[model samples]
Target: MNPVLGQVPVYNAYGSVPALPLGWVENYTPTGQPYWFNTITNQSSWVYPMMTSKKIPGTNWLFVLTHDGYEFYYDRDSKTSVWEQPEELKEAMQELKKLEEEEKLKKEEEEKQKALEEEEEAKKALEEEEENKKRVLEEEKEQARQEVKRIKLDQAVDNAEDVEATEMTEEDIMWQLQQMAEEEVGMDREEEEEVQEEAQKEEEIKQVEKKPELSEQECIEKFYQLLKENNISPFAVYSVELPKLMLDPRFSLVPHNKQKNLFNKYCHELGEQIKKEKSQNTKKPENEFKELLESKVTTKMYWDDFRRKFKNDPRFKALSVTREKEALFKEHIRNNLNKKNPIEDYKNLLRHVKEIQKGIRWRDAKKLLEKYDVYHAIEDKDKREDLFRDYLDEL
Candidate 1:
């Protein structure tokens, strides 16, 4: 048996005369010029006594003479034959397998070619899409540029037309001025003639006295009207230019005393408004606290130090009330000492005293501490002596 090509050395059996190596009958002329032969037998090595066959007319049967000279009838209807040699079968199978493999390779190549074409088509489509996008963007940009250019051109043309229509040349301006001067001269001559006529008439009739000018109240109201028209604040009564302002003919009737009284009333009103604003501002706790902190009184300075620093300050001077000053002093002390017992509070204060005298001579620091009654804190004689020596060495 052959595993790859199935069974080899296969044999065929007909009916039972005796089994022989299979041989095929052939068509031939009487001179033995064979036309067709089909056999898988080893007939060249075996001595066959005879071999012959005759096709039965009108039927698919043959009378064959076997190698042993036995006459047998082969019925083609039975379909028994080993007509091909082993080598020929193998060769035919190999050709068929090669054809199948070639067909499979051809199909795979065709599929790969189709896929490549599709990929190329897709790439071309993508490139065309990008090109279209870029073209649209460029067209939009061109349109926008053309729109801006059109706007600028229109503006330039409009400006040019305006200049041409209304702008005056130097010669034209000079001619206009000359014409105005001539008209003024003619008017002056007419006025002179009228004055002469009026003078002649005055000699014929006595003139009545003119009524007195508008009174001070009316003058002041006119002055206020001018100020309102000019948007000047009414509270500007104390402006340095008040005398110049009074030079207007309307204000000429206003007595100086009345003006002084008016200015003083406005000044008082302004002061009252300022005081009201200040009081309102102080009513807010944040504003008051901010002012207190900015004074640097509570956090950075002892009461005595704060008083020493700000004694001349108007706000500090306003602390003249004894109760308020005492309360301030108590707040300062409480902030520094918290709620500690007297002994602890005094010790804390001594720490500040030590800092104040840090660079002074030890003897001087001791004298200062003793002046402040630091010794009263120590009842034990030895501890007091030790404190005295410590103070002396502090510098």
Candidate 2:
């Protein structure tokens, strides 16, 4: 027994134990020894010369046997050793190792594929979620737009109803016509009385100037001089004096019809003269009445007061000449009454249009001017500018 194997008893057949094996070699030596130990027992043993010893053909270890059988191999380079197992066990272990490696590789590939699939699933889910959100937002926007459109449409309907509500009734038209007829009848009576009184006064004044009454030509020359002196319309004079002229003694020899025709001819000539002289001062009563209407002067009382105040003015008389004319004038004014834009807005728009006009944008100016009835009468482009300046000065 080798001293390095430690002191231990060796067992033989029949369980007889001894301090050492029966055929154990003592002080053993060999020509070439393998640096090896029994790996299973972690011990080195002595080899007996009588036991068979064979050198493994292609390895460094010499296969040796001792009286007690045990086998192991040594690595020449690593100088490490392992016990030899049974042939069946060795084959089974080799197969198990190969199978483990193949299973490991397959498991790794499966894990990688799973990860790729999970990533794709997550991306698809996120895309679907985003698409749903975008669709929902679009739906919300469309709903909001529809709601706004509905509100605007409702507002338009309400405005149309309001406009319709403000329209004049048939009763109002009849009332206006009745008032106009009454005012015309009163004006006619007053005019007839004034004409009679004026004729009486003229008879007394001309009684002393009867130095053989003036000829028709001289009478016409005097009439022209009177028109030049008095800046009055021919219609104003014609309404009162045409009949008087037809009955005057200066035209007694002339047939009554001839005198009437001559007076009409002179009246037309005087009208032309009046037109030339008063054209600059003439204003459209339609426009003036529109202003008064805007001022809330809609009653017949107001109109009658206006007529009494400006009775001497030919323009006022012209406007009130007929009930039809008066009704049309009021209708024109009512049609232009914009309940939406108050007087203040009208003034402000007038100023804004003026600024546009200063830049020579006449077409744009005309469009704005059309909103107000008074502006329609401002037909002349230069006159519109003057009106703008005058209104600004007033402001």
Taking all chains together, each candidate's TM-score versus the true structure is: 0.21, 0.22
Q: Could you give candidate 1's per-residue lDDT for residues 318-378 as a string of tens digits?
A: 5456456645554544444343344543445456674445445545655655533223334
lDDT, model 2, position 334: 45
Tell me how many residue pairs clash in candidate 1: 0
Error of 2 at 378 (Å): 99
How many Å off is the CA of 9 in candidate 1?
Answer: 20
Query: Once model 1 is optimally superposed onto the true structure by TM-score, how far is the C-alpha of residue 313 displaced, in angstroms?
Result: 99
lDDT assessment of candidate 2? 0.53
Please count the clashing residue pairs in each candidate, in the order shown.
0, 0
Scored by lDDT, model 1 comes in at: 0.53
Record all residue pairs in model 2 with backbone atoms less than 3 Å apart, i.e. clashing. none
Over the stretch 1-395, how does candidate 2's per-residue lDDT look in tens digits?
A: 23686533232223323223334433434765533344333456653224344444334543434447755444455544445533434554566557768989999677556645654566587679968976796687567656755775677568556765577789966876686577567756765786688669768877874645668777656555544454434445333444333333443444433444555666687778768779758777766655544564432222345546655754445465556445655454445444333344445557755444444445666676664544543345666666556565676
The Cα RMSD of model 1 versus the native structure comes to: 51.7
